[model samples]
Target: MAVSNVYYTNMRTTLQENLLQKLERLVRKAGMMDMDFENKFTAIKIHFGEPGNLAYLRPNYSKVLVDLIRSKGGRPFLTDCNTLYVGRRKNALDHLDAAYENGYNPFCTGCHMIIADGLKGTDEVLVPIDGEYVKEAKIGRALMDADIVISLTHFKGHESTGFGGALKNLGMGGGSRAGKMEMHNAGKPFVNQELCVGCGSCKKNCAHGAITIEDRKASIDVNKCVGCGRCIGACPVDAVDSMCDEANDILNKKIAEYTWAVLKDRPHFHVSLVVDVSPNCDCHSENDAAIVPNVGIFASFDPVALDMACVDAVNRQPVINGSYLAEQEHCHHDHFKDTHPDTNWETCIDHGVKLGLGNREYNLITI
Candidate 1:
């Protein structure tokens, strides 16, 4: 396979040129402007950082892309799907609040923020891509409707995937509530009985008739439940929950397949910043100390190659003393592995390569 070009620029900045300016320069050098953006609806997929998580990329970073896109006559919007877990971002209203609280509002990003999956997490588009795992990916309706897709990722370690990079930001982040369930579990959800109010909201929303209200309690019939995750959103008390029982390796593969479904027929670009380098995902309410020193920013049309390059850059750094990585036993000789021993981040990349997402071999072009 041929090697893709991954552009890089160190975090160093001069008095005249700040980090944001450097980022603009890097993306332009990486060929972000090569695509025809005239009148296109560009979806900039990003994590607004779960409320209280301080490690996600700031809205200032996103404004760079928003401004650039608008300059090219493209309509840009920052978007992300509702989370499967019960959090501040579980619904559109709360999700918008979390985003604005994190400074991702229109005033900051120079574009509107959209909760891709609608008021409930049930609004989705079925994208069929025959992969080994996912046959039809349930992606956010707004995300699939965009003319272009761009991922603005914050590179960090993850308990499940070892590291969260471009592909994780695109695949896992792009999934609707049900899409996330399919990737993380066996396509089934269970009710949290303690939290169930038996309001019949879930029962009313379940198209499969899998939910039953028994003695003022809600229970899901797994046999009949199609795992569309509609009930999860409809439950006012947040009683519905995903099983999340899929094996780690399988989960990674499903994420890659979902990524293919998102980017298959759209013009896409990926940009990842290896800053903060948190020990766990930004999905966490709290972010740990950095595991390693800041690497830099990387961009490419090829997400697989972009991720590969970022991982390589991160592995080359010295572990930060007193950080999570420093506290762990360094048996893997890899920072991400040593940080999250149970995870094998390679599965996603290898599966992405097999899916023809991008080449694993990349030619790093430092600017």
Candidate 2:
């Protein structure tokens, strides 16, 4: 594997070219414009930032890409799959409302917004791939339907995967409800007996006869449970929950495989903004203070190299005083690891390399 080219530009901006202009210049210099996007349906995959999270990428940045793609005769739309967790983004209606509240309305992004997994988060296309962990990946239907995939990620620290970069955006973010269950857990969802109020919602919605209710408590039969994750979404009182017991390293590898499934046989591009540098993922409604100062924008054809560059850039920055990373023990040396001791981000990068997703060794071309 040769060194992939990862283009970068610092946060410095003159009066003439603002950050938006710099972003346009950066991606253009990185060769995104060279793709034959004419009349193609382009899916700009992004995290709209959990409702209260203020660290997400601004919709204005997306408008730059939207406008540029339109200039090339490409039809672009800002998109993200519904989250599996019980949150503002768990269903398409709630998810779109959250996106609109977070400033991702069509007027702001210069494009439409699509909840890739549809209303209930069950609309998906199963894609088979040969990998160590995942054999078949359930990807969001709208995401797979796009002619081109583009990950516009907020490069920030994540407690689960060490960091949420391109792989997290495309892999974990691309999965439908069931696909997320496969990545996050080894088995089906279990009912919290204490919280289960004899509600039959889970039982009624279960396509498989895996759920049983007795004595005002619901129980799940592992043998019959197919892990479709419908129960998790159907439980109105949030009594159902995924086991979520997958090891972080294995979770990273599965994420790599899912990303492969999304990008394989498609012309894909990546962009990561290392601005917030939060201690946890944006899935949290409340974002923590910045661990490190802001790095600039990164773009590449190689998602692996793009993540590598973003993490590398973050590692070089000095920690901010009073931030969560500053309070933690820094024996790990790497910023992400120091922030999240249990997580190993390298697993995703390595697995991506093994799956021929992209190269870890990158030439950082500063624009």
Candidate 3:
């Protein structure tokens, strides 16, 4: 296996170097300063936690990167695409509201926040990947328009795909609503008539004529539906949704493929903070107790190696007393697996290697 370099630093601070200053030194040593940011439109892809989830990374850390990028003459902005599910982040207006609620405003972060997919999450650019699962990825226009992409992720356990790391953030997070449906399902969508009020918004926006209205309800014609996910964005009532039926293994593979579409041939970098250690994704409306103590901050050019190193670090830590991981049976030896037995986080890592995203093996260089 090819070995990659993953730089790490423990969550220790002193009067001389606080965590923020420590982060700057770590990234600088990891070669973030080597990138040519001059005159580049840089998109810092980050998750603005769901309104009620307090486990997301604070906006303070982002300002450090923003200042560094601007110092190098790069025009940096914080960016994320709209969500597919019904939530505060399902559209640009509401998504911005959620971000603002989480303290991600320009004044706080020294940059602007952009909902990459525009008003309804329909604004997308189709990039051909021709991978095993996804032939073409529907990425947000703003992300595709950027000259450089930097993924700043919160490393934590995920209910569906094992763990949400750099690959999840760049691949799944970079996708437009249509692209998300492709990764989460069999590239098709269904309507819940109970929530549909026959507004005909879906039917009006669908270019393929895949949706119809009857009896004050809307139904989707799967045969005619192209699975563009425009209806999911069009539905005012949030009735349209993907089946979310894709097997976790395939879901992980598709995430790797989509990650390729976002980073291939682009100037890219990744950073992940193994703090909070939440047992579930930050997408949740409410955060449960953290599963483990904070490990540290990590940086790498190889995203796969970065994720691998993070999980290893987390597994090495003793589970917190009375935490979710502590309550589970420890037979698996892996903290993430013990917490969510059905999930195999390795699928994403091995598939990432297969797709040449990065090496799963690494030399962890502690800073």
* Clashes per model (N, Cα, C within 3 A): 0, 0, 0
Per-candidate TM-score against the hidden true structure: 0.98, 0.99, 0.98
Model 3 agreement with the true structure over 1-367: per-residue lDDT tens digits: 5688999998899989999998899899899989999999999999999999999999999998999999999999999999988888999999999999999999999999998989998899999989998999999999999999999999999998878999999999999998999999987999997888998999999999888888989998889988888898888888988999999999999999999999999998899999998999998998889898999999999999999999999988998998888888989889988888888989989988998999978999899
Give a tens-digit lDDT track for model 1, residues 1-367. 7889999999999999999999999999999998889999999999999988999998999999999999999999999999999899999999999998998889889999999999988889999999999999999999999999999999999999999998998899899999999999988989888888889999998888888899999998999999998888888887888999999999999999999999998899999999999999999999999999999999999999999999999999999999989999998889989999999999999999999999889999998
User: Scored by CA lDDT, what does every candidate get?
Assistant: 0.93, 0.94, 0.92
Residue-level lDDT tens digits of model 2 in 63-108:
9999999999999999999888879998899999999999999888
What RMSD does each model have against the real structure? 0.9, 0.8, 1.0
Q: Residue 246 in model 2: shift from native, Å?
A: 0.4
Question: Which is the winner by lDDT between candidate 1 and candidate 3?
Answer: 1
lDDT of 3 at 151: 90
Instruction: List pairs with backbone clashes in candidate 2.
Output: none
Q: Which stretches of candidate 1 lie over 4 Å from their true place?
A: none
Count steric clashes of candidate 3: 0
Model 2, runs deviating above 4 Å: none
